[model samples]
Target chain A: LAKTTQPISMDSYEGQEVNITCSHNNIATNDYITWYQQFPSQGPRFIIQGYKTKVTNEVASLFIPADRKSSTLSLPRVSLSDTAVYYCLVGNSMDTGRRALTFGSGTRLQVQP
Target chain B: EAGVAQSPRYKIIEKRQSVAFWCNPISGHATLYWYQQILGQGPKLLIQFQNNGVVDDSQLPKDRFSAERLKGVDSTLKIQPAKLEDSAVYLCASSPRTSGGTYEQYFGPGTRLTVT
Candidate 1:
């Protein structure tokens, strides 16, 4: 399992861009980085995923550098509803059955009104 | 287009008692997973099933925990003689896992177990 580290908490206001970074210095060559968001009393939801470079979607953007040692999840113009615990996962998606999807401690994003 | 479904929403049991949780994955989804989320922590994978076959269950404590998927559609996780530490939210998720691995997982509402 590739160990990952992220901030324990972050704070932002509505309309602000929130960027949470995760570090996985020992990430394997086949490992891909994925992010999930969880609200209180609710299960997590997929946010974004990327192997290398940048991948953007309507909700968030994932930026992975060439070294692949770290990645960032960027939420654009966030709203109060975006306040949740954002978890970072590093695993081998291609080798689906070989390894399990492991999650980091996660970053708690608090969006103020 | 229904997502994964979990039942009983919440359960409370005493130590040494037994409890079971059920999950129904989305139609056509081939990969199902069970996870335990402790308070203030990330979800930990307990088991993963590819259709009706078990793929990974290294984290599961076989002494008290067991899970199974029937007909590659629905799954059940049970704990015998539950322990206090077993109090956590049990989550069920599923994904299509297309040829190359879409890696998109849909999660259910989860069953919160309170073991006293």
Candidate 2:
């Protein structure tokens, strides 16, 4: 498991693009970066995942630098409902037998109108 | 498709009492997971089950916490003589079996426990 560091909190206005960065200095070759979002009383929902380069989906985009030491999650045209806690996790997804994820204190994004 | 289902959305118990939480994973999912999320913190994996067999439970406090996934579908997590620090949300998530073991997890609305 690779430890990740992210900003504790971030504030943004509605309709603006928001980006959150996570640093995993000791990331391993087999590890993949995954992001999840959680609202006040609900469970975390999967947002995006990537091994390297950039991966985009209907919801968000994940950008992994060439070094793989860090990744950023970019949200476009953010709305007030997008406010939530975002978690960045790095782990070996190939470990099917035991894929217990380790989560840290996530970055809390506050989308204000 | 129906997502993971959990029972007794909330529970309240005394410090020395026993409590249990139930979870029904999505149909056909071969993997089930139990996680504990304290306030203002991220979720911590407590146990993982691969079709009725325990795969990992290193973080679970064996003396008090125990879990089982019978029939490889529904599961139960129990705490005997719970402690105050046990107050947190118990989350149940399941993933479909896929190649490379990289399937996205589907989570249920967790059960919130309050130990007084």
Candidate 3:
């Protein structure tokens, strides 16, 4: 499993865009980057996933650079309700069956008003 | 479709006592997972089941922690003589079969365990 690195915490005001970056220097060729959001007292929720380049969905956008060593999760127009811990996971889909995911401490985003 | 369901929502037990947690995965989901989440930390996978068979349980402390999915639908995790460090939330998640490709996971409201 590739170890992921992310900031411990981040703060942003409501309606502001928040970007969280994760670095997996040893990312494998088949590894895909997935981001999950977990609120207090709740299970982690899937927000977005991407292998490379840029992928956008209703919740957020995943930007993976050409090197694929790092990826960023961009949450637009955030709100107080969006305050949660964000996790960046790097692993291959096929490997998930044999190996469990290694979730980092995660980046705690405090969306303040 | 209904999401994964877990029972007891909360459990309080004294060290050296036994406790059990139950989970009902989403209907028709072939994959079930048990995770342990300590405060201020990310979840750690304790076990994984494919249908009624165990696929992986490398991280589970088998001496004290044991889990089973009898009918491949509902599962139970048991702890014998629980310890103080065992206090944490136990989460259950399910994912559709990935026979062809990748499938996203859906998590349930975890059961919080407090061992005093």
lDDT of 2 by residue, A1-113 (tens): 57899999999999999999999999878788999999988999999988899999999999999999999999999999999999998886466333438888999999999
Off by over 4 Å in 2: A96-100
Error of 1 at B104 (Å): 1.5
Model 3, B1-116: lDDT tens digits are: 78889998999999999999999999999989999999999999999898999888989999999999998889999999899999999999998886423457789999999999
Which ranges of candidate 3 are over 4 A from the true structure? A97-100, B99-101
TM-score of each: 0.96, 0.97, 0.96
lDDT of 1 at A3: 84
Candidate 1 versus truth, CA RMSD in Å, comes to 1.3
- The models' CA-based lDDT, in order, is 0.91, 0.91, 0.90
lDDT (10s digit) by residue, model 1, range B42-74: 998899999999988989999999999999999
- Report the CAPRI category for model 3: medium
Worst 10 residues of 2 chain B by lDDT: B96-105
Question: Per-residue error at B89 for model 2, in Å?
Answer: 0.4
* Candidate 2 positional error at B42, Å: 0.1
